[model samples]
Structures are given as C-alpha cells and as structure tokens.
Target: MKGGILLLRSIAVISSSVATIISTMLPLFLYVSTPNIELISIFILLIFSAFLIHGVLTHALNDYTDHLSGTDTNSPAILSGGSRVIQTEVFSVESLGRFGKWLSILLVMILLVFLMLGYYRLAVLLFVGLWAAVAYSVPPLRFSYRPFIGEWLCTFPSVLFLGFAGAWLALGSPPEWALQNAVINALICIAWVMVHHIPDLDADKNAVPPKRTSVVWAAEKFGLAWSRLPALTYYFLAFTCTAWLIPERFWAGAGVTIVTAVSALFIFKMNVADPVQVSSYEKIMLMLAILNAVWLGIFI
Candidate 1:
C-alpha cells in the first residue's frame, strides 16, 4: 500500500506543472508590469497551492480513467501513458479511482472558498479548469481520445486556465504586454502537446481501436515525417513572435530554439526506423528552454 501510494505520487509529474505556473506567474512578478506589486503574501501562496492541487488532480484523474478504459494497458508509451501502477497491480484501480475523486472534491471546495472571497473571475476560471481536468479523460467527453479536435481542447485548458488564473489573481486585469505574453505562452503550450503526441503516434495508433490523436492523424494523412513538419513550423512561428515580444532576449530565445531543433535532428537519427520513444526528449528540451527563456527575457 505504501509503495502504491508512492508510485501514485510519482506519476503526478508535479514539477513540470510547477514550472508552468511559475513561468506564467513570472509576468505578474515583473516590476514594469505590476509596479510596486506586493512581493509576498499569504494569499499568493494559497493561490500557488491551489494550482499545484489542480495539477495533482489532473494527473490522478487522468490515470484513473485511462486505467479503467484500458487505454493505459492497450498501448503504453513511456512519456504519455498513465502510470503503470494499475497495470502492474501495484494498486487496485478502485483505490486509484477513489483517490482521484477525493482530490476532485478537495479542489472544488478550494475554488468555492476562493469564490466566497469574491474573486469571481479567478473562481470561474478555476472551475473551468476543474471541468477540463476531469473531462479530459471521463466519458461523454473524453477529450483525450478525440483525435485532432482533442489536441486543442485538452491543451488549451491546462495552459490557459492555469496561466490566466495565476495572472488574473496577481494583476486583476492584465496590461497589454502581460496579456500578449499569456497568449503566446498558451500557444507554445499547445504546440508542446503536439511535441508530446509525436513520440506517442505509433503507440497510440496500435491501441485496441487505435486512438487517432493529432499526431496520429497527421501521420496518417501526411505520413510520420510530414507530421513532424507542422510542429517544427509552429515552433518557428512561436519563437519569431516571441522574439518580437522580447527583442532583447530574441537571440537568447532563438538560441534555445535552435538547440532544440538540433536536438530533434539528432533524436531523429537515433530512432529513424521505429520513431521509438524519442520525441519526448525534444519536447522536454523545448519546454525547459521556454521556461528558462521566460526568466532570461523577463526577470534577468
């Protein structure tokens, strides 16, 4: 049971989520954006905790539903599949399901408290987040399995909701610069999901009924190599626009993007035949660079 609980925690991928909220919050922290912004407060920390709880809820529920639907068992990929605890029998699926449900209830209760505090917009966004987190995997609206449509539906919430929730709470109404940055970051977030799906294309296609995710759809329509083109193209557009947004850090950002492109090329060579489980590495590099570049461009 103890081991099971530990494995459950490991799969939350909390650190990545933390990176997201942190980078999103970075814009709010800048002196030029929120002049004389209150540096620290109990409320800010409470909001931060809420974001983490929300992250945990998303991961836990996603794993539970995927396990129940047999998707996790059908065709597992290293980076994108639910944690294998259920498949391995490390924990009963029932127990995992209960864990996710309780987490959901806890998050809803927190949002209600925020509502009572009269942060209407913040609460509403968080509620949308709660819905997206659950519905991403649940039936009647299992967005994750919806192929091309699912990609935007699933990625938009995590980035937009979590990102804006932090920004709105911090700035009340974001200025033009902050708003543009949020939208750009959200686009990058959406593109990042494509990066994730790239490595999972073959695995997802081999599923029981073949889950045709965006990457799978692209691979089917245009071939796997062509599927890679859209994502690479999106990154260039993102970084080019980002360069304009923060010209001082333009080259720094481009440098990171260049390194990621090079890394992608090398990874391509490493697993040319199978497409293996290698695209996940490039995704990680791109994400880290985005997070790091935010700091370099905004804070540094």
Candidate 2:
C-alpha cells in the first residue's frame, strides 16, 4: 500500500500544476468577480479537467515514452529525468503506458462533455492540449525527441492554451489583455522549460533515439557554454513582451520584468557544463516561472 501510494505520487508530479492553477484562476479573477454558484462549480470542474489533462495524462505519456526511448533510463535522475517511478521500481513501463492510455480515454470523455455542452472552443483547446501531450512523447510524432519542435510545437501551445483556458471558458473568448498575458506566461514557461532541459543533455543524447532538445542542439552546434542560448532567447522574448506591455499594464508588467530579469540572470550564470549544478538551478527556475504566472494572474 505504501509503495503504491509513493508510485502514484511520483507520476502525479503535482508540483508542476502551479501553471494550470494560475491559468484557471486568472480568468476567474478577471471575468467572474462575483461568480454565481453554478459558475463557481463549473470553475472547480474546469480546474479538475485541466489537471487531468496536464498533470496526469501529460506526465503519464511522458514518463512512459521516455522510459521506452531510454532517455529516462539514462537520465541524470535529477529534475530532468522523467518521473523516477520506474527508476524507483514502484511501477513498470507497461503499467505506466497503460495508465497513459486510460487517461487518454478519460480526457476524450471530458472533451466530449464540453462538446455536448456546446463549449466548442474549450473542446478544441482541450483537444490541442491532448495532441501536444501525445505527439510530444508517443510514437510517430515524438516531437520531444527532436530539438526546437518539442518546445515550440508541443510545450508552447499547450501552455498558451492553458493560459487562455480560464478566460475562454468564462467569457467565451479571451480579451486582448488576457491574450497578451497568456502569451507572456507561455513565453516564460517555455523559457524555463528550456533551462530544465540543460541538465538532461547528456542523458538525452545518449538515449536510444537521441532526445536532442533545443538545449542539446544548441550545445552541440555552439558549445556547452552556449547551451544557455535557447533559454536565454526565450527569456529575452518574454522580457521584450513584458517591456512592451509596461506602458499599458504598469505594475503587472513591472512585476514580470523584475522576476524575468532575475531568472535570465540565473540562466546566464548557470554552469551548463555541470549536470548536477544545472539540475539544482532548475528548482529555482521553476520557482521564478511560477512567480511570473502568479504575478500575471494577480496584477493583470
């Protein structure tokens, strides 16, 4: 029973749910200041659905596929490796794969629910999120095994949709401000995710099919010292967006700017050559990314 509990915890990866929570709450705060009981109840269900899609299904496929491709097997076993359930011997690869399949079915059921309710927009967004998670890790597409494509095609859109989720569900469409904020949040997310890839470079390269994340590709093309480029590039993009928005949303923009600047500095100073050190820094990066999301939700 104890082992089963720990295995479940490993795959849950609940710590990563901060982005979904913030994304859901942002629209609720902006659109439903005094939401009725029905709206609030629906909001709660929406949050659950988001978690089911992202935190559970996404991680399930990721952990299962990475294990199959040997990336997780060779992973540095820090923040970068897939969840450590398989490594810890609490779950088998087949079991994890089965879990992913079950979750996929569940996600489709939720998507159908939205469709039946005429929430076509929400259904489409959820479908996109599902596609990203599957195509990113599963066979055929396996975008996560390639550089740039994974983050840009998979991670970016999934997160952008998540940021737009609350507003879309509540207002039936996100306002300009919400859209801009969603873009910024997505940028910050991908930026930090790039950093998260740094420590896994060696493990990824050594994987069976070679998970050449953008960070790994940059390191090979430029040098390990330059692996920071991909993350820095995204962070700079996020910084530029926030800077552009400063004139309109002063406090919110300023909050993101300060946190982004600090995060970029950390990435700049990161010792990319040391997997252990880079792994340690990823926790801090994750914190800053969450802070950016929180600030956007509250102040925007």
Candidate 3:
C-alpha cells in the first residue's frame, strides 16, 4: 500500500504541478492591484488542485499508453532506469489506468464547479486543458507523437493560458499588459521545454511514437541549442517596450528585465554543458518562478 501511494505520488509529478500553479497565479498577482483576497485565494487553490489531478491523470495515462505501444520497452537507459515509473513496475498497469480515468473525471467535475461559480472562461480553459492533457498521451490524436506540436502544446498553457487566466481573474478583464505579459510568459515556457529536451534526445528517438522536438533537436542541435535566445530576447523586448510606453512603471520593468537576462544566461550555459542535470533544470525553473513573482508584484 505504501509503495502504491508512492507510485501514485510519482504519477502526480508534484514539482511540475506546483510550478504550473505558481506560473498561473503569478500573472494574476502582477495584473491585479487589489483583487478580492479571499476569492482569489479560493480560485488559486481550485486551479492548483485541478492541475495536480491533471498531472496525475496525464502521467498515468501516458504510462498506460506507452506500455500498450511498446514505447517504454524501447526507451533509453537513462529514461528507462532512472525516470520511467511504469516500465519499472512502480505500479500495476491496470491500477494506473484506473487511477488515470478517475482522476481525469474528478478534474472535469472540479471544472464544472468553476462554471457554477461564474468563472465561465476558466471553465472553458479547463475544457481545453483536459483535452490537451489526454490528447498528448492517448492514441488517435496523440499530439505528443508529433514533433514540434507536442512541445508547443506542453509549454503554451503554462506560458499563455495560465498567464492570461491569472490576469483575467485578477483584473476582471483582459488588458494590453496582461496580453503582452502572457506572450512573454509563453515564450519563456517554450524555451524551458526546449532546454529540458536536450537530455531526452536519445530516449525520444527510440520511443515507438517519435517526438518531434527530439528529431528536430537531433537534426539541428545547434538550432535547438539557440532556441532559448528568442524567448530571452522577447522577455527583454517586452520589458523595454512596456517601460518606454508606460513610463511610470519603467524602473520595475527594467529591473525584471535585468533579472531575466541574468537568469537566461545561467540557463543557457547550463543547457550548453549539461542539459540532463536535474539540479540545473530545477534551479532555472525556481528562478523563473521568482522572476515571475517579482514581475507580478511590481505590475499588479
């Protein structure tokens, strides 16, 4: 039973789940000056919970699908031995499938509650979110099998949807700042995904359903290596544009830009030398969260 619980927790991918929630909430924090604290708190909790459920369902479903497709068997040694839960018998295949279904259903129910509370936009977002989660791993529309599409899909929600949702929830409407910031966030998220893929190059190639980014990365390692540049450039450009256009908050924007630049440099160096290092990824992600929080504090 204890082992089962551990496996379930692993399926949840709690660190990634928390990062998603934080990314979503940070945008809201930045855009709203005096949002209703209690309501905002509840919404954050609900969204975080939804993401947790989504993560668990997505991982479990992916594991089940991989097993069926024999992708897990062909996975590289690094991924197969060190990372993959399903391949190692961390949980029974049947149990994982059951958990996946139940968790996905529970997430949908939670989204319905959001609709009941007049957060219709959030409800709609949840619908898309659920679809993305399932389609990424399942058959028929397994977008994850597609090269570039999978990476974009994986990162966009954290960057765009979460940021927009946060701003919308905070201000009760979408503003230019919200939209722009969301785009910047999305770029950053995409860059992060590209960097993370540097390590998974081998495993992704051998999988039954080959990943797009993996192929792309293999073909054009240099191009993929420089992928983070555009995102970093955008972050700085956005900050600069916002500062010049909205002079009152110029300092704040510039400050965030400086931090983003420094962080991007660190991330770029880490990716160049050791993409597979878990600590590097964690540190970069943590810095991103902090930078986002600071940006929100200044803007909202």
Worst 10 residues of 3 by lDDT: 75-84
- Candidate 1, which segments miss by more than 4 Å at Cα? 1-16, 27-39, 42-54, 74-76, 243-280, 283-287, 290-293, 296-300
**Candidate No. with top lDDT:** 2
The whole-model C-alpha lDDT of candidate 2 against the native structure comes to 0.75
Clashes (N, CA, C under 3 Å) per candidate: 0, 0, 3
* lDDT (Cα, tens digit) per residue for candidate 3, span 198-258: 4545455566666545334444565645545434444455455455424555554565566
Q: Tens digit of lDDT per residue, candidate 2, span 92-137?
A: 8888789888878887898999999997987888898899889899
Q: In model 1, which range of ten residues has the least summed lDDT?
A: 10-19
State each model's CA lDDT, in order. Answer: 0.58, 0.75, 0.56
Which regions of candidate 2 fall more than 4 Å away from where they truly are? Answer: 1-17, 20-27, 30-39
Residue 47 error, candidate 1, Å: 7.4
Rank order (by TM-score, best first): 2, 1, 3
Where does candidate 2 clash, by residue pair?
none
Give the per-residue lDDT digits (tens) of candidate 1, residues 1-300: 553444444322332344445555665565534543452452365355544544456656766766665566764355556656777776688887888788778879989998999978867766776787777766668777776556467555555555445556666764554444544555555555666666566666776546666667777888767666545554555566655555554544555455446644644554423434454455565555455436533632
